[model samples]
Target: MISKYQQLRAQALPHNRATLMALLKKHGIQSLSVFYSGSGSTGDTDKITATPPEAVARLADVTVSLHQAKVEVLAGVAAHALIAEKKPALEALREFTLAWVEQTHCCWANRDGGSGDVTFNVAQDTCRLKHTEYYTGSLHHEYSL
Candidate 1:
């Protein structure tokens, strides 16, 4: 008896990296993950994994996510693998992360014509959007408010 989420993830298994990314974008899913598994002699036994981003997206410190330490996350990591790509799904996530970071700017109605910069680490799966301080000499500020 497969759950609905399991079915959805199963459907994604046959698709390539590009299609997975497109589905993420289409679903407005903010985050996704792709990890690898196995190092056996078969040489073809290694597997890649994909997970829902929000599964790790809350109350995260600058250094790590407590959610990632769960037993379930470690399990089933190799049960389903995606179709191989010339570029791994990790790279697809990088491109998606870059584009996702680009659209998160807010600098149109600043009285001082303020601007901002985006720093995103695909490997760390983190994004920071820092905006210039209001009426300050381009001093950047943080905090999501």
Candidate 2:
């Protein structure tokens, strides 16, 4: 299982790589990976075979995990400015998590299969998937693990 910190970092790639780098740098989050979870045209078919080699070529502390169902990272979100301004740690985490999810749509990559009923829980600091719009929730539940 990938750490929540790393997953969030990779997902943020679409929004701002520099922001992610800075965030990770401040907190010392070194491990990272990008994962994809989706079904194929047929029930038994598989689409993705390899991770996007180019995705993390230039990014440090990041890797790509393709054709997988779930990814998790253990990380705290914090505002770069707040850190620079010397704000409280908890305050920065709260603001950063909300902004990260709202600004960056990590689940957007799985659009063809629907947002997959994706939900980001700031309180729990976890991303949840109840189901995919294209398939049943059971499949998602299995993939989620």
Candidate 3:
């Protein structure tokens, strides 16, 4: 029998990216990631901007999570294929991850915040893929909270 995680993952798959962005926006989140670099000596001022096309693409492929509901999803991924061999590392990750999810979801308290989060971990030979989201808004409290 399929586990509850599998079922919820299936349901959350369709709206992963969009759902993440929506939640992030509602919580006044401006950037998904931030970075810093240093120069050896004197450095010239630099300006950074987000490209429209890139922004759209990034938004198109984000992870989704509903913290209040204790659910997480990854869109367009094959979960079973991931654990075909049941490697020790994968199994350990799975155990820790599920436990973490259980704790977070069980204690989530943003009911009226319309806040939620989701993450997607895409499998790769070298390193597994991963994405995460957190959103806050009025809807979070009304339904899933």
For residues 5-80, write the lDDT of model 2, one tens digit per residue: 4555555433333443344344443433222234342111111111233322333443322111133334764422
* lDDT tens per residue, model 1, 1-145: 8544445444443232345434345444454443221122111111222244453333122121111111233554533332333333344444333333223322232343333333333344454544443353566778985
Choose the strongest candidate by lDDT. Answer: 1
Candidate 1 segments exceeding 4 Å error: 1-108, 136-145
Q: Residue 23 in model 2: shift from native, Å?
A: 0.6
RMSD for all candidates, in order, please. Answer: 20.6, 16.8, 19.0
Off by over 4 Å in 2: 1-15, 40-145
Compose the digit string of candidate 3's lDDT tens values, residues 1-145.
8566655544443343344345445434443321111123211112211222244234333433432223335696434321212223222223333333333443222332112222321221111122232344454345564
lDDT of each: 0.35, 0.34, 0.32
Backbone clash pairs for candidate 2 read 3-72, 3-73, 3-74, 4-73, 4-74, 5-73, 5-74, 5-75, 34-65
lDDT of 3 at 115: 21
Each candidate's clash count: 0, 9, 10
**How far off is model 1, as Cα RMSD?**
20.6
Candidate 1 worst ten-residue window by lDDT: 62-71
Please give the ranking of all candidate structures by TM-score, highest first, separated by commas. Answer: 1, 3, 2
